[model samples]
Target: MIAILKTGGKQYIVKAGDVLKVEKIEGEPGALVKLDTVLMVSDGSNVQVGAPTVQGAFVEAEIIEQTRGEKVIAFKRRPRHDFKKKIGHRQHLTKIKIKDIKVS
Candidate 1:
């Protein structure tokens, strides 16, 4: 079975035993997090979609780790002006392992 869930203002499609990185969540490694915003679910042959979210449908996941993505560099330059600027950024992320999905 697979499910599409929302967390931290983002949506992700996940299945059991799948590990994915999402926006930072408040938890440590091995923490159990229940995702209640289930948008859709499929069970091999049948699919169910919600108007906004499926009631009583949830997905369980375990926090694997909290990390940061690769740094992105932003550079600006002007010809014959000697003006230049450089910046770098990295986004915080949390890795979670999907354990199960319950549909009701």
Candidate 2:
């Protein structure tokens, strides 16, 4: 079975045993997090979609690790004015492994 869930203002499609990186969650490694915003679910043969979210539907995940993504450089230049600026950023992220999805 697979489920589409929302967390940290983003949506993700996931299944049991899948590991994914999402916006950083506040917790230690091995922490168990329950995501209640399940948008849709499918059991191979049948599918259920929610108006906003499916009531009583949830996905359980375990925090695997916390990491940061590759740095992104932002550069700005004004050709004739001789003005230049450069900045870099790395986004913090959390890796979680989907343990189970319960649908009611």
Candidate 3:
């Protein structure tokens, strides 16, 4: 089965055994997280869509690691002003593997 779930203000299409990187979730490695904001689910010829979210539907995932995205550099300068600013940032992320999708 395949499912669409929402977390960290984003939606993801997931299936069993799929590993994905998403915004940071508060959990340690090897922890199981249940994502219940399921928007849609499909099983071959049958499909189910939710009105916002499907009731009793959830996706189970295991936390693989806590990581960070690549650094982003921002630079600003003013001509003839000798003023410059440089900044860098990296977003916290979590790597997870989908274990199952259950639709009741």
Scored by lDDT, the top model is 3
**How many residue pairs clash (N, CA or C atoms closer than 3 angstroms) in each of the candidate models, in the order given?**
0, 0, 0
Among these predicted structures, which one has the highest TM-score?
2
Off by over 4 Å in 2: none
- Tens digit per residue, CA lDDT, model 3, 1-104: 99999999999999999999999999999999999999999998999999999999999999999999999999999999999999999999999999999998
Residue lDDT tens for model 1, 48-103: 99989988999999999999999999999999999999999999999999999999
TM-score of 3: 0.93
By TM-score, the candidates rank as: 2, 3, 1
Estimate the Cα RMSD of every predicted model relative to the unseen true structure. Answer: 1.4, 1.0, 1.1
Candidate 2 TM-score versus the reference = 0.94
- Alpha-carbon local distance difference test for all models: 0.95, 0.95, 0.96
**How close is every model to the real structure, measured as TM-score?**
0.90, 0.94, 0.93
lDDT, model 3: 0.96
Model 1 scores a C-alpha lDDT of: 0.95
Greater TM-score among 2 and 3 belongs to 2
Q: Candidate 1, which segments miss by more than 4 Å at Cα?
A: none
